[model samples]
Target: MSPRSILFFLTLFVLGITASAQYTEKINSNRPGTSQGAFSVGNNVLQLEGGMGFGKEKHKIFDTKTNVFNFDYTVRYGLLIEQLEIRLNGRFRADGVKQTVGANEEKINRSNFEINTLGAKYLIYDPYKKPKKDTTNYEALKSWKEHYKFRWKTLIPAVSAYVGANFVTSDNPFTFPDDPAFSPIFAVIAQNNWSTDYGGDWAFVTNIIVDKVTTDNPAIGWILTATHTVNDKWAGFIEYQGQKSDFYSDDILRLGGAYLFDQDLQFDANIAFNFKDTPSIFTFSFGASYRFDWHTKDEIIEKPGLEGGVKEGEEQENEEQEGEEGIDGEFDEIEGVENDSLKLEKTPFINTFEDDSFREELEQDLDERRTEERLERERIEQEKIDKKEGKKFKKEEARRLKREAKEAREAEKAAIKAEKEKQKMIEDIDAELDKMEKEQGVDGELDDIDKQLQELERMENELNQEEKEEQKAEEKKAEEKKEIQEEDVDAEYEKYQLQQERAKKEEAKRRKKEEKRRLKEEKKRKKEEEKRKSQEKKEDNENLDIDKELEIIDN
Candidate 1:
């Protein structure tokens, strides 16, 4: 391609690469910037980003001024996996070139596809795929900053690789006369996303691209972009791009911002400019990005909970059903064993005395009857023992459930008492604040104090609501535990008792801390009130003295 055409193609390539490499919950559009994110659009998602722009380029050496209009589009589809995407990027430009050769002016109009490429990108490494384990010190006595210390692992960036082929038709006006019909392009992309203490998230993306390697005039380029999420709906970016080739080389800068219209759509506007007398360029573009999301939620297998921990609601119900079925099966087996013993009792005595001896026959019959009676008695006794054990197990389970229920009730009562105390404290503070406001005539400071009191009440309500929810959760957990195996019941109950004890201790500590804080605040308020009264009295005394002095002077 000619240098101007090369420049235009490179610009389009830069624009097209700006898309995210991975799927995001919110449509991560690469629009309004010129650096590709190292993430994909996610599997089964189709995204389209397009822009139209007008530009002016002035070539000093050729004494030519060109007015350019271009339309660029990128179609990206996540395929097969979350980390892979196939993309089609193309740009068409129509240019009106005006040249002056010593008072001879010439006009040339050229229109064609300046750049077209189809590529597949795959993420090779993702630093954020797995979250780091939290290791911060959360002790009450630790400094607050200790929880937010910087993690060195965050420095690693997600990286991706892209390989694509560039297509150029023969005799295309945008290409050089000797340019090949097809060439290869390759790129390595890296991106880092980090959060600032100011609550804004920042992203930096870098792309190293080698385009048209098979062509006689190959180009190597790099793009660096820094993006900041201003808020939930707005983002801004600044980018720098540099490219070098035998045919064309220049540095370009871009600034842009995007608005998240919704989860799957974005609107953006950007401007790009280059510094060079040989061919100075400026462009402005407005674009929008939208996606057809077909992503499905991935199935997640939860890890097993702690020992003696209850399962989820549905799982717990299933477990309970299974346990009941097992108990029924055991009962059936026991009945089968009893029937087998009865079959033994019904067996006829052996006819070993074949000779017709009445005495021996009578004796045999007696002995057999005695043996049958003894077997029957033993079977009845075994049945009684089994029934007794069953009853004992049932009684134990019932007692455990009842005990847990009682404990839960007691805990609820304690919580309610604490909540009442908190509410009384809030009411007293509100009453005191009202009295102060009435006495002080509703000044700014008093208004601030009232606001603070209202805030405290609001927080108290939230805490009460949380506590109620937690209690409900605990009740549900206890109900689920009723299906625990007979062997595990005692162990689980002991563990739960220990947990309750620990929770009581923690609650006591929390109450003590709260009471201490409240007293400190009350003391501070009283001291401030005393200081204010003293100041008022001193002011009144001074006024009286001044008034007396004035009277004496008049006399």
Candidate 2:
């Protein structure tokens, strides 16, 4: 490729270790290095980093040379949460070659894209932190390698492994299709991180890789890297990578630096040097990387209420720690006051120049003063407790008194009501007596007439008794006569029956006679009427004759 094409793409790509102390993806990119660290992007996050590389090589086999212009694009996506990740770190390059045969020159062009590694990373183990009973002593906190001084990576490391394959996804420079163009890479990786006071923190990453297709020998490669935070926005690192190829064994050492343009964006650059004289290759890289979530993690970061509960959890823990610190402080003060042996060990006598007698008296005075101070504190605490209890007791007593007073008032009202009711009952009895006296028509005694009437009624009763005795004698005689009548009772009954029959017959006859007499009178009256009518007729004739005579006379 031409220098115009090579120089225009001077890009160096880098990835950050992590965003913060919080849970974020880690990038092991030193400014320009080829040592991938033992970390992946956070769960559900994506990372893209790209850069350009320029390569010039001379060949001894055909006396031909090649110039390569290339761009490298790295991609990493986290899966299965942080436990697994998928990565594609590849390069797209164009190669131009020049060859001469007996003064005739030939130029050839070859361009293709190659994936350096497409792989998955699995986490096997991570750091384990033991509980700290006393946080005040930071040394009491147990970690994996805290005992191993100066060995930073052993302190606390997360262990992981990776499996990948390198492939060239094109057909070129070969007449046949049956060629080995793919290789498998398997490796184990580890990462260790620590914090410093001034420059933030540091991380060390190491990987042991096995490349099956580097040659028929199946080469082993290694990368050991160290990262240091320059400050909040800047960081730097050094990396060492080495492997024995079929032709020569080479080692690469790289130095790089990174700067944070923003919280979400970072820029980095590095230069790499070969350690061998035979096959000397130089590499330089620089680029920037940015990160973001699909939705607004800013809401959680700004409000602390959207998603990140860890902030509040940490805050609660800090508050509890503060409370424990306060209690520890109080205990320290109390210990100083109580542990007289400590004071004595520090200074047995305040007045060293004084005589023994005087020292004794001073010590006694000091003891008394301490005693008084302790007594005062106890008394103050007691008073506070007693004040609350006293208020409670007072309220209870007031309630009891109010209840008693209410009961007494109710009992008094009942007594008064009962007295009134008793008086009303006595008055009712007296009123009834007065009404009876008035109805008697005498004030205190019955009238004399009433007594005389009673005596007269008694006398009449005696006379009635005498009349009853005479009636008894007459009734006895009538009984005797009835006994005699009983003897002929049947005959007398028969005679009475005969008389009744006769009377019935006579009544019937009288009724019949009366009926016959009414008919006879009716017949006699009819005959008399007939006779009178005839006589009236005769009289009428006579009157007619007289009228005629009168009429003749008048004529």
Candidate 3:
């Protein structure tokens, strides 16, 4: 190509770079740490992350010293938002080795640089931040929690997996990883992020990894990271990494933080401390990511999803406002215009230069909007705390009530047991009394027999006669018992006749009393009627005598 053509192409490339820079995008990174997060930059975005670390190692047997220097640069391109990404990331490592036996010092392979790994990560599944559905207001959407809607704190982890390889580019005799070959590395990742009660975000990321570090030996490792987002611009993380190989096992703890200058750029620093050694590595990195449109502005009218439609709507509103102002201004100009064919054109800059009204409004409200967001987050945090506390209190109250009910039942059982014991004691006393009464009766019988025995002793000669008398008495008693039975039957018959005579006398007495009552009633009734008739006759005689006296007077 000619010089002029090359210059033109370079100018065109620079213009393209400027155009791409105009399209701003925000990317959440998962780098400058051991564990990978289940997230991606939006489609057609370019992200680059780079870091460097220095390490020193000491040996006791040979009294050797080694200094390791490392650098890594990773580039990621998002094929699909939150779904797929292609990454080219690798590390450049150099080691300084020193061998000494007390005073015998030797410096061998003073410096070496080798590319450590080149890998690609593909996200397989995400319980959050996947399926990329656009919220109604993208700017208003704060977190991806709503996408999951609900999650079990212990059970649901956003899961992902990726496969990659590591290749050694340099063939240095004294460098580590003597084989210049590729090693396959595969990992299954589980991650989760949650907001704490104090309005901070906490993230947990874990990886189960298998990698072929040597030709014949494969290494199995695990990485666990706990990340806390202190605020919008600062995030701190603590990580544990352990790898087991055929020869040895090594463990490391990484502590780090990232400062986000803005959504599109970040700076990070971290230190990795080995369990075998005191401090293994220290790293610091700077990274930036950007997004741009694949098509020119003239060809593409709107963005995708909700944010896309928002731009069009804002433009339409501005246009309509300008149209209304133009109509009004043109009509006023027409009233004084001399040329009938010419129409006054109203342009934003024609009359005078003025401040950008929209820009001014944005500048004025930026802090106000930030304050509102902070208050909203605080309120949400309080709600979560109150809900958790309420649940705890309810559980405690239920447990207390259950305990009380159990105690009540135990008390009732104790009362019933006491009542049963009392009844049993009473029954036992009654049985004991019955047994004592029987024993007393036996004692009384024995005393009567002793008295009879003494009386027999007083008359020894009459004892035989007494025996004969007892025998006769017994026979006589038997006959008497039969006679008594016959007499009892006769008495029973006489009792029956007496009962009949008594019953007859009672019936006659009742009848006599009833006849006397009836005669008394009849006599009283006759006396009352005769008295009434005599009174009435006397009243008539008095009236008649008066009349007769009057007649005599007249004669």
Candidate 4:
């Protein structure tokens, strides 16, 4: 093929490859709802997307070469089975063409519109398995799955065909067909991923299109494209499009990038060099798309709660606070003492009963007090050990209760599952029994089996109902336990607040006593200073008197 012819096919190939991949009949296509089979499979999804672009279009010299502006859109929906998929594809397009006549003739313009073509595809084989674990890491698992797939096109693999009429305005200069032209197109497309989870990675795709124009004795034309993604978003491709006759051909090579924002939206842009020979044509084209889905699915996990400890702690704090407050109230009931002696004695006095000893004796008593405190501390430590053991016992009881409840729940679920399996088995057995009866004459053996199956099914159903009732009882018990826990937490929080209040009061009392002691010491130190100054003055006076007396005696 001539370079121009090669460019032409390349351009057509680019169009096919860039078109929406949805496999459903576009409502706008002239042939509406025709190919209504499965076009895509694997996920039940629906998508709507469209694109508009401007590019140089060249026809035969005498026939006229034109710049073509076009807009197209498609909507698709598909069913995705575990290993199979079916899809419905649809598309529509409108084209504006400017053509030039021979010898620098003025250009002629025309418009054509087409819509509503349908198609479908089925995955003959897909190499993937259902996830076996609840926490299957899809990212890691994806690498383990096959990267290739085989599919069957209900009609033809990777082909989009639509029929529509082209109407030339009455004022147009070029000769045109009086009747609307029928345009039928067929294409084959292939796509594969290049080892990346992110779709921006490399991809290889190609397309082949065979088309028949409505006019000119049903002349045939074809286009081919080969595109390779150098990376996730950048791609390079070459295209050739031409009719069988030497009259029409164009070759083009394009380097472009497709920005896939997500599975729902995509944008593509390309710069093309057209080898038309007469006047080298440069073209830029851009496109965008949006996809939609019908049904969406997701998974959620259940959670477990903690045993009740915070509630107990809070209750303990509250009791301590209450006790502190009671102590404060009792201390406040005591008469306030104002004597300087009272201030001196503000620190808690060791009870000085009639038999209390002197200072050295007090010191010895203090040592004994310290020894007693040590012994008391040791006893309290032992008591705490015993209390901790008691708490452990209570904790064990709580754990046992929880375990029993859990076991009850598990048994209920097991019974339900067993019942379901039994029911299924009974159904299968009945089906087999019917088949055997149909094949053999009605016999006592078949009747006996049927009776047995029915009895077993009834028993299973009764057991399932009983298990369900027990499950309900357990659920009610759990709910009550939860409520009790909530109440305990509330009570504990209240207790903690009370304890904090009582601690604050006790701290205030301690601070007040310290302040009084500080004031008493200040008063005592001031008194002593005044006394020392007075004594010094007296001694000076006495010395002056003695000096005067000695002087008199000498005279």
By the lDDT metric, which is better: model 1 or model 3?
1
Query: Model 3 compared with the native: what TM-score?
Result: 0.44
Q: After aligning candidate 2 to the native by TM-score, how far in Å is the CA of 414 from where it should be?
A: 99
Model 4, TM vs. native: 0.33
Sorted by lDDT, highest first, which candidate order results? Answer: 1, 2, 3, 4
Cα lDDT, all candidates: 0.70, 0.57, 0.56, 0.43
Query: Which regions of candidate 1 deviate over 4 angstroms?
Result: 1-24, 132-142, 197-199, 298-555
For all predicted structures, in order, the TM-scores are 0.51, 0.44, 0.44, 0.33
Kindly provide the TM-score of model 1 when superposed on the true structure, using C-alpha atoms. 0.51
List model 2 lDDT by residue over 125-230, tens digit each.
Answer: 7552221121222232132243223433335567788999877455844212333568788989877665432335666677777876554656677777667776
Compare the candidates by lDDT and give the number of the best one: 1
lDDT tens digits by residue: candidate 4, 1-555: 565565555555445433422221111111111121212322455555555656664455445455656565555554443212223333232334444444456744555443334434443321111112223232432332321232222112222222223333343223233423334545443433222223222222344444445445343444344444454333444444444433344444565655655545656666666555544556666666555544332111111010111222543553474467642342243224211111111112323232323532543444344344435545655766788999999999999999999999999997787667656655755665565456443244445545665675576577657757865775565566666766688755654565576568657855765675565556556655655665565556556555644554453
Stretch of 10 with least lDDT, candidate 2: 297-306
Which 10 consecutive residues of model 1 have the lowest summed lDDT? 338-347
Worst 10 residues of 4 by lDDT: 299-308
Tens-digit lDDT track of model 1 for 71-144: 99999998877788999999999999999988799999989999999999998887654322222222421333
lDDT of 2 at 340: 9
